[model samples]
Target: MVDASGRQARGEPQGELAGRLRALQELSGLGVRALARDTGLSSSSLSRYLNGQTVPPWPAVVALCRVVRRDPRPLRPLWERASNPLPAPPKSSRQGRPLPRNDLPRDVPDFTGRAEQLAAVFAAVESHRVVSVDGMAGVGKTCLAVHAAHRLAADFPDGQLYVDLHGFTEGRPPLDADSALRALLAALDVPSERVPQDGLEQLAACWRAELARRRVVVVLDNAADAEQVRPLLPGAGPSVALVTSRNRLLGLDEVPPVSLDVLSPEESAELLVRASGDPGGPEGRLARDPESAAEVLRRCGHLPLALRLAGARLRHRPGWTVGVLVERLAAGASEFDTAFAMSVRQLGRPQARLFRLLGLLPGASFDEYVVAALADLPVRDVRAMLEELLDAHLVQQPTADRYRLHDLVHQHARRASAEQDPAAERERALGRVLDYYVHAAAAADAAMPFLSPGAPPTAGRPPAELPPFADKNAAFAWLTAEYGNLMAAFETAAAVGADTHVYELPRFLRAYFARRCGTTHLNVLFERSLAAAERLGDPVRLAEAHSDLGFARYNAGRLAEAAAGYEAAGLRVAQAGDARVAAELALRRGYLSWDAGGVEEPLDLFRLAGKLYEEAGCPAGAAHAAAAEAWATLQLGHREEAARRPGRCWTSRTPTPPGRPR
Candidate 1:
């Protein structure tokens, strides 16, 4: 095919052929070899092209023109006139409808809140070459990633390529790195047969080589882990990659992770409002009570799937009110169970069982030991099972050795547990898990001695196995790993109506999980325990739980609620004939009322508390109460009497000297 000058003879249309070839040969004064040296195309390809034996592909033609010192525009018209056309691609097949998030269509409603997370994710996209959004399952990681990507797509010229690694899709194996690379290669137009097999390194090289000098954006969704993502990274040139994974993917140190937490109340409401699909209508009226709206989000956990489903349910029947929806959500276990259950049912039976078993464990997140206890299997088997369940998205593997499920998913798992085993069988199974954690936590607590209302247990039942407490360091590590799930178990047990668990788990955990660990969510969950106590209607435990919840509420800024709760606890104590605890609650109620703006009813509580304190034979408590009454006297403009009281040994530590600034 080489012509006399060693250039590949050029190919052209039979009729216009001679003229185009004559023009090209004339343009290339140095002929084939010279053009080959300049363009990186082989002399044979050039000669074949010039001698008219073959037509050149676009890139080849562009190279030829560049080497020959000619503008491509002259050949452009003729090239454009050529009859070549690519084969049509196969029609896209539908598998199932993915969650309809507000990440696209420019019109879908985005939930409110996460203003900081939205900004953080956007900053990552704009600032980094590759960013990953990683988090626990149903934490809205994908929503945050996709929303950010679509917002930044303008900067990526070659186009955005979004592929779900399907790493966690039910019943699917993770698409290996090589196959994912091939998919990327195809999107970039490398000839299918030319794609090298088994040479993933080579394929990756080719993919980057092709993508060099262009701006491209690639999103790898639901990756199993870093190994599955390594080859797909575009290392050769300018590009951005956004990877979402259940695994933390710490293996990729440079892939900055946006490990998402659950949505806050505001964000949940915004999502509910959008899902409710109202335009200046009843949805607005419903959203007016963010507390109830937050309750819905709480039941749904503000996960994209759960929130979207909640919206879908509301939208499906416009006649329903928010309160009605709340009534349905108050169904406790069955609220979002149907939808999350189907998501689990789509998984293999083993993975589904693993997911259900995860529900039997405590916490929003947990260590592998809980898995071992629930499955009654070796840690290794539980590890593998957890891995598979995570990849199927039936469970979320946030970090190595830690996993979680959505609230809705967790409820369904509990239902599955209740159904799959005999009552004793299930109780014993769950009891082992509870014991495993409590035992482990107790050991960690003994070793660490975190800040709490109590002292080192000079006592209680001996633990099953002592953690490496002899090594001061290992205890910290174990506690760090197990802390979240330990707290989660307390809330989980209460939610599951686990009678002993409702009260005992908190007592066991409060010693280990504390403010030093930044465990503030405990305050919110204790309120739920109060609700649980109310539901159980046990007078002694109810009063104790109410007092616990009341203190937590006082610390959490719900002062009025705290005051009311303490008052309610006093009533419960009174009914139970526990006058001593009643007096303690009276002191707390006085303090709460005094702090929450009063010189009136709070004055009443403080005065009453003083009488009770005196009657209870605690003079120091009475003196403290007298000090608070003195302050209430000052606030109500009884300053002469206030001057007379002289801060008589304040009965409560709660500061009560000030009144609302008038």
Candidate 2:
């Protein structure tokens, strides 16, 4: 009996088939020759079968089964497997082939999460000849690919080959397809002289031919794009190739692509704990403060590379708490900056400039129009540049028409902007964004009548072209989507001494804040507006600012502060000669006084405000003051006076309801 290679099998028949055959022979209580006689087969053939050196023909096995009184069914499957062993590589192919190289980087010891991703990759390689893992820089695409490749190494016995293509490396051009193929050829043990010194197609053909019958795993890391990776893929066979890149590599649609995102919060903490070297030490301490640990992870953007760097930093600095590291990262001093820079450096000058300007944007995300406004570029150009940035993985579109920078990438872009862009240019870009936001908010406010019925008018000229919105719903949606950014723009305006914008932006937002019933951000926006108004020292604006601040404070239930704010605004109201506003301020102060148990004082203040409002031609304000006086009169236990005051003073309109003051 012979093996698949046509050589005589040596040694005892091995594995399950050998054991079963030997058992049957023993059960027959016969030596090879005796078994052969009993089974009607030649002695040498029986000997070979019994030794697992060959598979006997079915009739011969049936004769043996009868002699041994054993079943042939169960043994037949084992017999088949033993008979058809996996084929060996041709002698010539194996003679000078390079030794198998286990070139994969060490798997991350504290690698956390990604079970689903790993399974997807494994499943993909089973059917697809090639798979690519892609994601933003520092998102751990290479790490994941390497780990999965190592798990699958045993299936491809010819070798595991790896090459770094330098796709996003700083100060270096990406490895071209021809050069990558040569490296792969050399790894496969094709002699240096034999590798074709020709075009990429010829070299790729030779590489594919070499892998035609072999089962090998090739990993091409940091690929710049599909073009750089195309020649490195092996031809159809048992071989598989895994490619990792920051770019999406959409050009390789034939190859299944798995995109990696940042780690989840829980997995991120686990990684930090495990990578910290002493989970029971500082990491353990951090575990007790999950909020702080979560903050650390958030500041790190839950990115594995950032987490690893932070974990290592914490591991080495036993004296430092996780909060310390969090503060550092929050201040934008992160190891991830270098990794992010590599991706940025790959961008074209226009795209890089857009990326830098995007970092200056106050919100977490923005639409193309906002970007256009900031960059002073046409909307179409902004959209195209954004697409370029998206393809490079420096920016991500979390949803349709909305692009956001990863926290870490945002930090890097900010740093790059500070370093590369001049101070004046940064300020100018920021000014443009603030101006755009102010005008856009005003337009939205104007379109939504329910929100701005009695809202204060903005002081600036209208923008030449308002941002397009289909209707009130679209306007409200835009406001809601950009609420945080609007707040940031308000604060930034104050910081940069854009005093007119500072005071004007909040006026447009005030109605939105009131309509949404947003107290927290309202307080912040008005406070910043007050500061800006104070800097300008315009008493009319000051009165408006103080009135807005008092309103926010009053809603927040800080009655004493609200009263003081109203009182301060009253002093400015007379200077500004707005008696109607003065009446409003007096009415607000009276409410605070009534809430604080000063019934008599509040009644007197309300009466005085009512007289001033009537004189200033604000009958609604006069009636509101009258209603407040009636309420104060009732609170003072004078039911008759309260009833009489309501009849005589509230003739035209009812008072603004309590807690509904705006």
TM-score of every model?
Answer: 0.38, 0.43
Candidate 2 per-residue lDDT over residues 280-399, each given as its tens digit: 654385766667778878777888877776676667567877677666666554548733554465578999999988888876668887888788888888889999787665777756
lDDT tens digits, residues 592-618, model 1?
654443336766776776677667676
For model 1 the local lDDT of residue 130 reads 76
Clashes of each: 25, 3
Model 2 clashing residue pairs (backbone): 13-51, 13-52, 98-189
- Runs with alpha carbons beyond 4 Å of true place in candidate 2: 1-349, 445-476, 500-508, 512-521, 586-659
The count of backbone overlaps in candidate 1 is: 25
Off by over 4 Å in 1: 1-5, 8-108, 278-291, 332-662
